[model samples]
Structures are given as structure tokens and as C-alpha cells.
Target: MSLSLVHSRALLGLEARPVCVEVHLANGLPSFTLVGLAETEVKEARERVRSAIQNTGLEFPANKRITVNLAPADLPKDSGRFDLPIALGILAASGQLDARKLAGYEFAGELSLGGDLRPVRGALAMSLALAHLANDGAMPRDKPGMPARQPKLVLPEGSAQEAALVPDAEIYRAHHLLDVVRQFLPGDTPPEVLDGWTRIAPIPRREQADYPDLADVKGQAAARRALEIAAAGGHSVLMMGAPGSGKSMLAQRFAGLLPAMTTEEALESAAVASLGGRFALENWAVRPTCAPHHTASAVALVGGGSPPRPGEISLAHRGVLFLDELPEFPRAALEALREPLESGTITISRAAQRAEFPARFQLVAAMNPCPCGYLGSSLRACRCSPDQVSRYQGKLSGPLLDRIDLHVEVGALAADELVNTPPGEASASIRGRVVQARERAIARQGSTNQALEGQAIDAQCQLDDAAAKFLNTAATRLGWSGRSIHRCLKVARTIADLAGAATVQVTHVAEAVQYRRALKAAH
Candidate 1:
């Protein structure tokens, strides 16, 4: 065969688009030609593939004219993930291996000069894309009358493990180029020993998620309660406090109180992490806590680039995004969080490509009460002027603040008070209550309270007469907007769930109202 075709995937944001590696060898002036809208990283794969084939003791078509085309030539291709497929296609076209055997299989891996197959990013995402397409019945058919063949993924060792995490995925792990070559040697005979080549099953980790303990934080019961309510309802929270009031500590331990991730949630979260090249087998099924620095830009939070990679918010999908020193972050960056906080997804549009990433992450943001971080503190006089305090609190827009379901104040503890304060309730105890409340909400409405909207919110968060009157009075007095009232209702609904109540009560409404003081001192 002088022409060979191989299947692979290209990542544009979270979606893994299909790409074809077509290799054609013809008699002409000896040369290597690569064509497609390929990026520099992909063009560099030519040398890597040639070196790998030669080092693996395979014949390289150096004397013959070789042309490799990554088709649909318009799709922009980056990364060395196409290296293995391009190498395989060249060999198959040059009559070194059976081209027919390459059907029904997808290959993606970076090759080292020593013929070793290195792991590539987005392996799990590619596997997930295959599953979605197959289950959605969109896979292309091999013959006119035949149904589409089940796709099998060929990846390097580390990447194979990640791909195997996808359920029922036919994943094969190849350690070296020679191992892959042995599989398609143009014969019906099987190799005596498939040493580096392996087929992995669904590798679901049974290990429990580990997080920073809530007991590490002391003397902030109100703040702790806010965290619990936020976790139970899947609501976003904003915590304002003086410096060293344990706001960051509480935020760090907040993930421990949320319910464990379901397999689907884990896969979505891990898939995004894998796209960011930050995934690990040990971190599987564990909720992520992404704490980007205050200096991070809007692009860093919302995700942007030529290929449009996922940012901190997407990486924190089904998990927590703790923004400490929230006011110190750029206003644009803070504003970028508003859409995802409501829609649970973020869409990034580049010049050539548009992609959306799941960003259903719990936001636990913390900020100082004032510029000096001690507004209304009993421990120290607030050094900043009233104007300074107003400007600092003004950093967060009303829309963004309204999107946050709970706002709580964490008071600074004096020296003697801190010394006398014992360890707070253990995270396991808080998590038990949180998980129960979450289950109750899910059982009642099929989703967390924060996800409820429109008629769903009114239906799920039904309030008693007294609670309704109280909430209305509070909102009227505070001049709350419609969004704020709805968020408060959701928070009250979560409080009711925690109390094992059938409906929101006056007490729940009152507690939820207290959490509405965005910056009580400034107000």
C-alpha cells in the first residue's frame, strides 16, 4: 500500500475534535513534506517520528518522497499527540506493517528519540469524546451496510491509565514504538509476549478524598456554618473578615464539607484537569480546590489561548474555587466568574475556534472587610479612612455579589480568646450533615438548591407564611434586587434541609438574611 490512513483527535478547548493522519509515499525527489494547518509543535513531530522509527530498528522512507497530511486540512493541529499515528501511517504506507489492521483504532502519543512513547495531554478527554460520540450514535460507519465499529484507543503508559478511567473504553497501552509495531506485523500470528503493550480495564479508585481539616480553624462558628450551608446547597459564598481571622483557613477546609464526587462528576473534573495537564491517578474522584493567585488575569480565570485551554474555573469543575484576597484580584477577573457561577459552564471564542468548558465549581471567595483588613475589629482600630473602606468594598460589583448565595462575616479573635478557643468541630462531622442536607435537596428537586431557577426555585424553596413575610420585610428594608432575593431563598432552603424541615421557616430566613451583609462595616 502506498497510502495509509490513521485516526486521532485534536483538542479545541474541552471538545476533542476528530483528525485523520494520511500518509502517502510516492517516487519523486527524496523529501519529507507535512501539510495541514499544523502548529509548530506538530511540525516538530516529523523529526521525532523519524528518529523513533530509525532507533526502533524500523526502515524510514528517507530515500522515497513522503507526504503526511493531517486532514481536514483546515483544522488547526498542535501538540506531538499525532506523532505515533504519523509514524504508524508512514510504516503502513511503506509496506512495513498491515494497513488494514489500523482500522477501528485511534492512536495518540508523543515519541522520544529512543523509540519510547511519551504520555500526551488530554488523553482522558479524547477517550471521553469517543464515548460520547459512540453513545450518541454519531460514529461513522466502516461500510455502507455495517454499523460503526467500536473505537479502541492506543496511548502511552501514563496516558493509558487516565483513559482507562473512562468506563468500558477499549484502551491499549504501548510503552515503545517496537511494541506497537509487533502488533501489526502483516501476519495473523500473535506475538509470544506482549510485554510493554497492555489492555487496561476501568481503573476506579476506591480511596476516600482527603482535604484540609476544618478543626485546623478556630473561633469562627458563624463562618464555619456559612461554609456548611454553601456546600449543602452548592451555593457560592463570599467571606469578609479582618486579616488572620481564619478566612483563608476556612476556605481551604471548605471542600472537606462537600459531598463526595460521583463517578460522572469525577470523570468530568478529571477530564478538565487532564486537559490542563494537571491530572493524577491518585487525585481521581477527589474534589479539586483551585486557588489561583490574586494577580491572575481574566484570561487565567475564564480560559483563553489559540487552542483555548481550560482555566482555573474549568479545572475546578464539580469542586471548589477559593479566591483569597478577592478584592485584590483584577475587576475583569472577578467579573468573568459571574456567568459560570450561574450557568455552570464557560464558553471561550477564539478567532478560528469556539469552545465551551464545564465550570460547575463551588466558589468560596474571601476578602478583607476594608483596605486595612480590620474594619469594625475589636482587636485593632481600622487604620484606613471611610473612603478607603468604601473603595475597597466597591471592588466587587453588585451583580457579582448578588450571584454569591451566602455572605458571612468572620471576626478577628483577640490573643486570649484565640488561646482559649478549642478546636472547632471536625470536618467529618460537618460533612456528614452536609451530605445529608445535599441528599435531601437532590431527593426533593433532583438538584442542589443553587441550581434551582425560575419556577423550580419557587417550587423547591416554598416558604411558610411567617418566613415569607420575614424575607419580604428584610428584602424591602435592605432594598435587595430580584437576584438577591432568589439567592437568599435558595440559602434558606438549604438551611431548612440542614434542619430536616419540610419547608423554609422564619429562623432559616433570618439566618440566610444575616449572610446577606456583603460588607456590614462598610454599609
Candidate 2:
């Protein structure tokens, strides 16, 4: 009897846990049995690995009893990610490859019947998990220095580039099963093929992130101002307007105004995207903008399942989540966003397991004022009655509205204004101002204005005496909740930062108050 072990990773939310693929070959009945909590796709690898080995002119030892077990018996394994490791384990156990050479290394990839290796999901997540395992991920090897012991990672060509993005990650890309087998041959006998295996080196990047220009929107200065403030301070926004009023257009362009992402932010964002299988190499470091339709359900909006996959909000981490026609979405779905909006994370609890995902997203939601699409529009009269409008707008609960930091009305533009208005400010010009304001906030409190907590809020937002007095009076008159008042203070602080002011003033408070009044009739 012979046994071999190959190391790999299992993804749970953003975390990647280590998994050991164990293969044992012994003289017994000619049957192959797979054990461990493997899903259908993983179990299906039995046929794939068998065919791949045989087609590559390698011995399968079909007469010998085969047993493949994924270690840590309770960890659920899914997808074709285990195919490569399982095949390699069998080869090592059958006395075809050197098993000891596999130490200090991990492998993941799907395999074709022709022995061609295919890309696997969460390649970046797997790389990051290895980094975290090395020295608790305290410092980047490239920045502070690599840990004393560095584990190598092997992946398919399609997925290797994404994994290589991690600084100092030793990533190897292979094209075929034969390519990987060559490395662990019983002895070092120079392989015939060279192109099939190559080390992927991390290259220095100087390219800037590209995004759609904001100059596409023509007018709506007030709505544009709200986007600027939201970008500068990391605040959420709710925009209500009539149809063809540039709500969706403005929401789509909102991501371009945010600051450039740091390397750490880029990794977190990419890891989440990788888990959802939506990550593209070209879109690396560019802030994402997820816009789910109104028909999405609560589970689809907040993320819930047997394994608990990330939802649209988590996919939009470090980016914008644009929900068009917000009031038309299911009431439960809209309400589920309340907690994540405030805490910047969402925890999905299942009967057996629980998973938490990061949802620090900038929400840019839009809606029509009433069922008829226009409640106060001068251009078109609303067809819905008073009660109909009330119920339609009431789909959004009070708590959800309170969590939003800015509310702006995107009014319908007159024909003359739409035709005559030149293109609004370019995204580059607006981004400059947003970056300056963000820098000021980071310098003062080491975070964005919206991230200020209880004592941090009072300590950072230094309101002048008159400004403080005005805020107190306004809160009393508006009947604002404590949450609403704090959000207003943060908005005021952001406004003061944009203007290069040392302290919050009455004018800043007055403008901030206007944002809260836009949705007074909704809830």
C-alpha cells in the first residue's frame, strides 16, 4: 500500500481554509471510492482524473483499490478545483512521481480529459490565504519583508496572472498535467517540454485605473454635488427623480469620482470578486459598481445559501452599489441592507455554518417619487392617487432611510436645459477635489468622515459655537433621530473639508440639512 498527500485550499466567504487531498492505493477489490464532504463537481473529478492520467500515457493502476479522501472530514469541498491535486496524489501514490518534492507547496486547478489544465476559481483568494497563513499576514514581503518560510503556489495559465498580483507570491503556471508531472519525476531528468511550465513574476504596475467619464451627464448640479460629497466622505446616497432625469446615468458615473485604491484595498476587493467568480485581470484595482435589478430577493441581495456566497453588496466592496428604482425592490430585500450599510459587514447565519462578508460599499440608490414616476414634476402630472403614492414610497422603511447619509432630488430637465447645457465637469477634475477632501479627513482622523464613531465623531467634527447651536435647533425642529443627527454632522464635516475650512460652520450645516429633507415624505 502507498499513500500521498497534496495541499490545497477551500474557500468560505473571503477566507480560504487549508485542505489536504489524500490518496491511498492498496491491493484489494478493483473499485475507486471517494470520501469526504465533497459536492457533485468534486466527486465527478474521479472520472476526469482517471481519463487525464491515462491519456497522458501515465499508469492508472486501475486493478488496485483506490481511495481518495479530502482531509478534515467535515470541510465541504465543491467545484473542480480538487481535480489537479487528486490526480497528482494518485501519481505519487502509484510510485510514478516523487511525493517528497510536493512539500512546502500548494496546488489547485481543474483538468480536461486530454490532460490540459484549466483555471480554478478564487485563485487570488488562495494566494492571499497562503500569505495570511505565513506570519499572520502582518506585513507584505515586498514592503516589510517575506516570512522566513515561503510556500509556493501552482495554478493553471488562465488563473496564474490573478494570483501573481499578490506581491512576492511564488506562482507557477502549467498548461497540461504532463507539465506538472515533469517537475516531480523520480529523478531530475531534464524534461522535453519547457513552454508548458513557467514561473509568473509579479511586475511593477504604473498604469492608472480607467473608468467611464462623468462628463457624459449634462446637468443636475445638485445631484452631482451629492455624488461628490458621497465620494469624498464615503457616504451613501438616495436619489429620487422622474424618468429620463439622469438618475441611472449619474449613479453609473459615481465610481469615477472616488479616490484611487491602495494595494491593500485592491487585494480585498479582488479577493471578494474572485470568490464571486466575477474578477477579471483587466479590471484589477478599478472600483466596481454593482447594480442589481428590483426583482432581486433578500437572499440575492444580502447573500445566503448552504455555503453562503457573497451578494451584490459584498461584490461592491470598496465600490458603488447602484440600485435603480429602489422602491420597486422587495420590501424584505430593501430592509436587509440596513445593517450592512451601517456596520460595513454582513453576517449570514445558517443552521450548520455561519459566514461573514465585507460590504463596505457606497450605496447610490435611485427611485421615482411615486407610482406614476412623477409626484412633483412640473413637466408631467402624476397619474397615481395620494394613497397609491404613499404606499409606493412607503416600501422603504424609516430605519433604511435613516441609514442613508445623503438624499438628493434629480429633477427632470427642461428640453431647453438638456440641449443647451454643455457637458458637466470631467471625472478627472471632480476626482482631484474628492482626493483632496479625502486626504484632509485621513490626516485629521485616519479615516473617512462617515467612519467616525461616537467619540470620534464629536472629537473630529469640531463645530463652531454658532454651528453647534444651529445643528441643535435644526435637529429639534426636524425631529431627527440620533443616527440622523450624527450623519448630518459627518456630512457637514465633509462639506467643511471640501471648502478647506478648519471647523464646521452654519453654512455647512444648512447645506447638509437640505440633503435630509429630500425624502421627508417617503417614510
Give the candidate number with the greatest TM-score: 1
Q: For residues 94-127, could you state the per-residue lDDT of candidate 1 as single tens digits?
A: 9999998888799999999988999999999999
lDDT of all the models against the reference? 0.91, 0.90
Q: Write the per-residue lDDT of candidate 2 for residues 389-454, one digit (tens) a residue.
A: 888878889999999999999999999999999999999999999999999999999999999989
Error (Å) of candidate 2 at residue 261 is 1.1
RMSD of each: 1.8, 2.6
The CA lDDT at 240 in model 2 is 95
lDDT agreement of model 2 with the native:
0.90
Q: Which parts of model 2 have CA positions greater than 4 angstroms off?
A: 135-147, 190-193, 203-206, 521-523
TM-score for each candidate, following the candidate numbering: 0.97, 0.96
